[model samples]
Target: MEFDPALFIDLFARTFTFWWVILPAIFLGLIVGAIPGFSAANTIIILLPMTLAMDPEVGLIFMVALYASSRMGAGIPAILVNIPGTAGAAATPLDGYPMTKQGRGQQALAISFVSSVFGGLLATIITLLAMPWLSQVAFYLHSVEMIVIMLFGISLIATIAARDTLKGLIAGFFGLMIGYIGADVVYETPRGTFGFLELYDKVPLIPALVGLFAVSEAFFVIEGESILSKRGKEAMQKAGWAATIEGVKIALSKWWHIIWTSMIGLVIGVVPGAGAAIAAFVAYQQSRAFSKTPELYGTGHVEGLIAPESANNGVTSGTLVPLLVIGIPGGATAAIMLVVLQYHGVTMGPDLFMESPELAYGPFAAMAVTYFIMIFTILPLARYMSRITVVSTIYMSPIIISFTLVGAFVPRQYMFDMYLALVFGVIGYVARKTGYHTAAILIGVILGPLLETYFLRALKMSEGDIMVIFSKDLANVLWVGLVISLCIPYAMQRWRAWKAAA
Candidate 1:
């Protein structure tokens, strides 16, 4: 666990020599990430044969670059078109799309890119230095502690519901009901599926995501000439590279926000099955909870965008920690990396660090390098990418539906998923028209099942004792933190109101 400046410096320089491999992968990752239903994990799987053909070091660097860049790419569409390329980017469009509607798409993209790169780079460095201790996070966070952590994310629903408690609660509970559609984990009986075989397994996330965000948004856009307002169109047309510069400045100004939010992702990523989605949501909730201007969150606040983008990208480094230190893959992407490493006859775990320190630490070093390269590579494209907003919705709506429908199909390749997406699309449109928050519903859909799984596991361990949640000291501490986090915004709001009255 001792930090070795010389060793890391050497690895960093060596990774730079693979810029040829890294550069192309970065571009490919952006494309893969921006497209709905595609992810670095599946894309890597599709290209496994090609990856396996390369040397282990080259392969790891390639995957690292692709993984980091893809995290950034998922934000681009989320910012411009209100389509989250992946679940991790789900919290992104809450603010990013609003910025686009106001003709600040270029600035938003710039902020997202900068926050992602720096946030990821910082986490990668921290992971390298603290890998020995950070790996222990997985072992310490048992089912009880994770339940509390899950609450941290699920609390976001209540936060979103703050403006109109009843409608938000209705939307959130509705999504939770939908999430429970599959067979109960403890028993084999289906809960809400209406006799469909596919429903017995579970409602697939990709179709649900694209349907609610992409397809639903596509439906609304057709009611206008463009996704932008008249003033927004004029501002966008007049925008130059200055907007990109403004974004970078904005992100840099919020350096403290990036640091803490990304740390949230790093800690969560160490726990197995706690993917970027949870990290992003928790970070956004915490950001809003602690902000002085909490009301500005969904209305295109820069911090709102930064919090999720930073946290999600920070997950890139944290996922590698358990993979290298404990022979456990933190996520699907890390699992694929494990296969490649095993193929190359490299054993993981602590021994790998001692026997082959280069391989053990090389990927993190490569990640740091990849993030450094990404800002320069993708930052210039924000100006051009933002222009998509000015396109006529007549053409754009069909294009979005076509691509999203295809994205819905790619994940499971079930014809049923496409139909399911349209169903959710109509549902989303109805909710939007009824003044309900789709993001609140989404938080429920994503976290409800996870909460149930952990809660059931805790209960099973405790012989169905409900108080088992309070059995762990770590769990108790997390509960206290969660309570404080949830209370702070309301307390702050009341304080401001009292001051105004005085």
Candidate 2:
């Protein structure tokens, strides 16, 4: 399909016309995203209803732009507080938190901002060039193929489950069971309602996510005496643009690392359900694998900050590709986006490009604009935001809990959601204290339903002949790919142990 210059220009104009909403959305999203526990997906889900009344295209632009920019925004708190604002930014804390302790917080924030812009822009370019072809490929996928794809996507649990295979699997199974609580898709039979009216619709994802990540995080953040108070205001004020420039120099010197990880992000982003957290983690791991001073990785290494930040942002754009072309969400943020698109009455898939290229391309242009704006907006404000780490826990505690509750309830305006949030908050706290990863559990929560729904559908359609899934060339290939993804981590873990023993 040929690019329509006139349509592209018109779409760009429309996107720019909504700069007022776009700008504030990005800015506020950054603040919310930077607050540990308030994830981008949760933020978007909470805010989605407000946008319901707006123009579809404008709403899409605002949310998508906010989603992309917030990935960078979340890094601020991750670096300063050793707490990730969003799951995607979790890897950022590995090196970012250490850097803050070393008085290099400004440098880490700067590198994260610059690398994120670079990765986001590069991914957008790839999205622009690849969307047409990808749309064509997505069009050929039948229901069975989609099911297989979802199963392969769910297998990412194995990579995530690496911390403790049994625990991970158990958490994932629980997530699947939770997802099954609502009415059955085919028979309308309630699976786990237990006579509760709310159970008829299953547990709402936004409230659960907000509770698990944000509200729980608030409790944890306040339980400890303030770490922020440790840094003097004068010392905290040292974070500035000078550090950012220094970070830029380091990133430029290691340009290859950025390019390689950005590519990794792009590839992972294109795969549905892979998400930014995985992209960031894998990139960080790969960067460490290739670094000359691998020992320096988790200890304030500049590349450690750059790789995951870039890769996660890169995945942001890649996540859009499948959504725009195939109507399939590539990540949690993208899944929320799918709702926004459907709410707007815009049907996705191959015909979307043919029928409403404007809607398809509007987000691409907005993402490019988001990248450009984020760099300028973040650099000047990084130091100021970093000082948030200095705020007293007493002052922050009530506010955090207030917003956490508000964020949880805003999505559905239901009081029951507040209780659900509280429950998940407790769950999150317990899990953290036990060394069980909240991220792994959240990943399961995000992907479990899709996996179970599709896998079961595929099996039933094939008359319980599970071999039909393997009978297809594409399914077989994905199955082998899943095996490789699982095995590599195990192999690496063993290698690391052996090297240490030697």
Off by over 4 Å in 2: 3-22, 31-64, 74-104, 136-180, 193-195, 221-224, 228-238, 264-308, 319-360, 484-502
Q: Residue-wise lDDT of candidate 2 within 1-502, one digit each (tens)?
A: 4677788777767677777877888887787777644566777877777878778878888888888878878777678766566667767876887777666677777778888888888777777767766445444555566555544433454344225655655665566666667776667777777777776776776566666666666777776555433453444567566767887788777777778888788877777766777678778867875788866876778888888888988888888888877778877778888887788788887787778787778788898888877777777776666666666667766776677677667656788878877888888788767656555566556555566566678777888887767767776776787677667767978999999999
Judged by whole-model lDDT over C-alpha atoms, candidate 1 comes out at 0.88
Best-matching candidate per lDDT? 1
Clashes of each: 0, 0
Instruction: Give the per-residue lDDT digits (tens) of candidate 1, residues 1-502.
Output: 5688998889899989999999999999999999988989989999999999999989999998888888999999999999988888988988899899999999999999999999999999999988989999899888898888777656565565336655766787777778878987888788788899998877888888888888899998888999888888888989999999999999999999999999999998888789898888888878986899888998999999999999999998999998988889988899999999899999999998888778899999889999999999889999999989988998999999999999999978899999999998988888778878777777678767777788989999999999999999999998998787667657867999999999
Residue pairs in collision within model 2: none
How close is every model to the real structure, measured as TM-score? 0.94, 0.77
How many clashing pairs does model 2 include? 0
